[model samples]
Target: MTNLSLQAVKKAFGPVEVLHGIDLEIAAGEFVVFVGPSGCGKSTMLRLIAGLEEITSGTLEIGGEIANSLPPAERGIAMVFQSYALYPHMTVYDNMAFGLKISGMAKPEIDQRVRRAADMLQLTPYLDRHPKKLSGGQRQRVAIGRAVTRDPKVFLFDEPLSNLDAALRVATRIEIANLKEAMPDATMVYVTHDQVEAMTLADRIVVFNDGHIEQVGTPLELYTQPANLFVARFIGSPAMNIIPFDVLKGGDRPALLIKGVSETVVSLGPDDKICAGGTGYLGIRPEHLRVARDGDMALEGAVLVSERLGELTNIHLDIGQDDPLIIKVPGMIAPRRGEKMKVTFDRENIHLFEAEGLAV
Candidate 1:
């Protein structure tokens, strides 16, 4: 019942429109992550829900009630910004209790809520310490504790872990995951450009591009079956290798062929029918391909670059195409650069897309 729903929400600054009409419904307790490259409007959409930005048109509903005109404080939502936003001079307890105190909650009640949040975040040991005295992770916890004390129906996070070191980011990410579990009924919406964060934390992810949601799905869903070349190229590390070609021109029934791979073919039906001899892109993830034997669609490619990371060897194949193909070879069997190798992938694993970037 604590869900958030956006009905054709839009935003504009003067004449420049920042977000096209966006429609999304977030269920109660769902952990949704907004992910996209810079200037993609993911953060702007988050701000729209936080009431930080006014909606130029359309409705925003929290718990089924229209809240477009509702101020942030009145919307019963607490936002944790990327900056942590804690008072440097104040003790952790005081920082956490500040909001309740300012709102004229009973002094005893404020103390009780702060203590509860401290226990939840394990901030009790550092309650008396100032923000400057705490590590980046601890101070960020205090920032979250502040929001926890307010006990808002929904929690909005704006890249809260970007400031931490690598080790601390991992630790804090786990802690935030635990926090979500502790408040299962509290709807949470997080915004991040980091794919790892999106993959690990989101129940569902919203992918944005050019001020519109390109796709929305679970992490695995987005990673495996991207809607288009943009998403196929964006979701994974090193990205999916895209080799563009003319499908229908190559053969019968509008089949897709992988050049450089000797005769590896994926026959497409009417659903994937390409304009006869028209162009399309062939996409395959690095992990799904190998440097060994290939079937009918196998190709011989030159290893333009090789990256050995102890656990795995990433072979970037200069497959005589515009889009350099990358194949993730399992284990540490290093392949030398400039060496010729046959790259293979299963037919089912191949993704076909039309000239317009729509999946076929």
Candidate 2:
């Protein structure tokens, strides 16, 4: 097991910089997940750590040793890609043990490692089966088992579950969570575009945006208190409902006007640099909005659509002047489209942000 650190790590292709000075420390035994949209340079950062790609600048350390000059094999890291890289003719057992054999390990040691990995991955029954005979999930398991056989200090997974079906992905995700539990000392870094996976699996999520670290924290922290508008909108389902508003107070008490809704007085003064009468956005999550069972901070609207996903329903409302706002209502209380509705949310639940996207 090892702690991995990247100090001011940057990557470039010719003159185009892809990663902009990433500084991160992955603690030993921690399951850290890098999550972002496509072209965010998350995969590239993982490749740099695996030594699959050369570091354009900065230092990379594994177990307190500088590894920038080291090759992939000597980096003490094993990588599992999205595509299960397996041998067509070789059986599962042979495929898992091939690397050890090529490294000149003793036959008995290779047998022990392969058997142990197979048992750990529940692949003992499929060891003699060819890749063509296994299911998609099994093939992915075999790919993971191959990496586990290496007994690497650090493990890198690049969207290893992307190719599986929804059901299989859930099962495999549990399998991976168990793998981390079993190997408590092994440092694992995962990269994915799935927010649900990131929220569920990671001890701490590193959110990347345009080759830079956007926000790094536990899933709920980033969701609840995003530093900027991009993260505020990006992390939530249906995203946060953002509407333009004016600051009503800045000299003494801080208050923001929500146009037709109501003027919300802040819990504290806008010493956060929000000027009076300046344009900004009011952010409120769909789940945070309260259904107007009674008249309280009421805003009338007509329902445009209602999506009932069994346990909960998402109501999209047309408020006339503003863009459509979604409200999450618990249970199957189906509200008809074009039905009149009133929505309200407490001042504490509302988020205030400056025009430049910064939270104020």
Candidate 3:
């Protein structure tokens, strides 16, 4: 097992800086995923770890050794890219053994490693098949098997499932997860824009935005307690609903008057910073909202659209705000357009953010 560390890592191309003082520590055998939108520098950070890009400044350590000047071949890491990058002319077994052969490994050892990786990845049955004859997933497995045969200390995957179809992506994702279980001692760093992959596959996830690290935590940690407004809006599907509000009364329990909604007192911890006459943002996830009970504080809005998606329905309501409020409820229920709908959320589900986007 190998651990990775990055201290104030910065990368720049010409006068444009891409990574801004990133500091992170990844434990041995941990699966860490980097996720962000395009041009967000997640992929650039991955390349820096792989020694494919030089760090403009700062330190990178792998297994307690400084790796800043190390070449890619000497880093003891195996990478699987989005493309399979297999030799079309070579059979699966040959493709898997090529790297070992080029490095002058003993033929017996090469055979053992190739067969072992093939068995673990379920590619043993197609060892004699060429890339042209194999399915996309199988060919990708060949690429992974080639990496596995190297037995590197760390594994890097750069959006390895992006090229496959929906079903193939799901199947390959499961295979990758199983491969991690089979090799528990191998450290892994994966980069992808898909939150589903990051949430499901990672032991911890690092969220990046605009060349800076926004937050890093386990999936549930980021989902339940985002550090700021950007993370609160980015982590969940359909995003969290944000509404502007005025602080009517600020104390241990602050009363917020949301626009077009009744005054509601929110219970906050003692350490929360809130003051009277201040304006802030109120956030609630769609799944947390429900139909209002009699005598409960509610926000009434006109139903703009109802999307009945089998297991759950997404109801969009116009609450006199810039964006419509969405409510996610179980089962199929279609409310007529322009009908008044009332919904209320629990106090515990509320998230308060100050004017500067910092969570309170």
Candidate with the greatest TM-score versus the true structure: 3
Question: Mind giving the per-residue lDDT tens digits that candidate 1 earns over 253-289?
Answer: 6576655544455576656555333677888889989
lDDT of 3 by residue, 139-253 (tens): 8889999999999999999999888888888888889999999999999999887778889999999999999989999999999999889999999877899988887663546
Q: Name the Cα RMSD for model 2.
A: 2.5
What are the per-model numbers of colliding residue pairs? Answer: 11, 0, 0
Q: lDDT for model 3, on a 0 to 1 scale?
A: 0.89
* Deviation of model 1 at 175, angstroms: 0.8
Please list the C-alpha lDDT of all candidates, in the order they appear: 0.85, 0.86, 0.89
- How does residue 222 of candidate 1 score in lDDT? 94
> Whose lDDT is greatest here?
3
**TM-score per candidate, chains pooled:** 0.93, 0.92, 0.94
Pitting candidate 1 against candidate 3, the one with the higher lDDT is 3
- List where candidate 1 sits over 4 angstroms from the true fold: 248-254, 260-277, 294-296
Off by over 4 Å in 2: 250-253, 260-277, 320-322
For residues 1-360, what per-residue lDDT tens digits would candidate 2 score against the true structure? 699999999999999999999999999999999988899998999999998889999999999999998988888899999999899999999999998999999999999999998888889999999999998999999999999999999999999999999998988898898898889999999998777788888998898999999888888888888888888888878789987777765356665665653443433334545533377888899998868777465666888999999889999987754688899989988789889888888776777787888887
Comparison by TM-score, 1 against 3, better one: 3
Candidate 1, 72: how far from true, in Å? 1.7
- lDDT for 196 in candidate 2 is 79
